[model samples]
Target: MRSFFRWLRPYGLVVYWVMLLGLMYLETVNNLPIPTDAEGAAFAQNFENDLSRNVFASLIEITCLYLILRPWSFTQSIGRVVGALVLVLLWTSGLFYVAFNADRISNVLGIHLLWLVVLNLGLVVILIWRVGRLLWRSLQQSRQR
Candidate 1:
C-alpha cells in the first residue's frame, strides 16, 4: 500500500485528472447524437434510451473518483492542486448530469429501487473492508517499531 502510494505520487495528479476528463468527454461526445433539422429533439431522446451507456458513464465517474482520491496525499505541488480543482469542476458537472438523469436511466434499465439500495450497500461494505485493511496494516507496522 505504501509502495502503491509512492508509485502514484510521482505520476502527478494532473495525469489522473486529464485521463478522467478525457475519457468522460470522449464517452459523452461519442454517445450523444448530433441534433439535425430532421432529427431535432429526437436525437437526444435516443441517447437517453440506452441505460447500459448511462450505467457505463456512471461507472466511469466512479473510477475517476477512485483515481483522484486513491492518493491519501492529494498533491505536493500547488499547480497540480489548481489543475485538480479545474478537473473537479468537469467531474462535478458530469456527476450532476448523471444525477439529474438518473430517473431516465433507471427507467430505461428497468431496475428496481431495491437493486440500487443493494448496490450502494455493497459499495459501503467494500469501502469499509479496504479501510479496515489499511488500518490493520498500519497498526502492524507500528507494532514492529
Candidate 2:
C-alpha cells in the first residue's frame, strides 16, 4: 500500500485536476435544457447543450496547462500529456459533430457556440505543442548528461 501511494504521489495533481473537471462537467450538464414531448411544441427549443461541452473542453485546456507547468516524474508527466491529448481529441471531435449538425446544435445553443469551440480547439492545440516541445528539450538535456 505504501508503495502504491508513493508511486501515485507524482500523479496526484493530475488526478485532482481530472476529478475537478469531472465534477464541473457534471454540474454544467445537469443545468442544460432537456427536450420533452409536449403537445404543440415549437419547432425549435433553446437547448444550450453545447454550453456544458464547451466548459468541459476549457477544463481540459487548463489541465494541459497545469501539466506543462508542473514538475513530475517523467513517466507521470508523460501519462498526463497522453491523457490530456486524448481528452482534447475527444472534445474536438465532439465540436466537429456539433458544427456538422448545426441545425440541432444551433437550436440548443446560439451560433456563438461554434466560435467558442474553435477557440478552445486552438488553445488545446497550442498547449499540446508547447508541452511536447518542453518534453523533447528535457529528453535532449538528459541525453547530454
What overall lDDT goes with each candidate model?
0.48, 0.54
The per-residue C-alpha lDDT of model 1 at residue 131 equals 63
lDDT of 1 by residue, 20-108 (tens): 44554455555555444563533233244354564565456445645645545543333433344455555555554665676333332
Looking at model 2, residue 141 earns an lDDT score of: 100
| Best prediction by lDDT | 2
Clashing pairs for predicted structure model 2, backbone only:
47-108, 48-108
Clashes of each: 0, 2
Stretches of candidate 1 off by over 4 Å are 1-5, 9-13, 24-39, 43-130, 134-145
TM-score of each: 0.30, 0.33
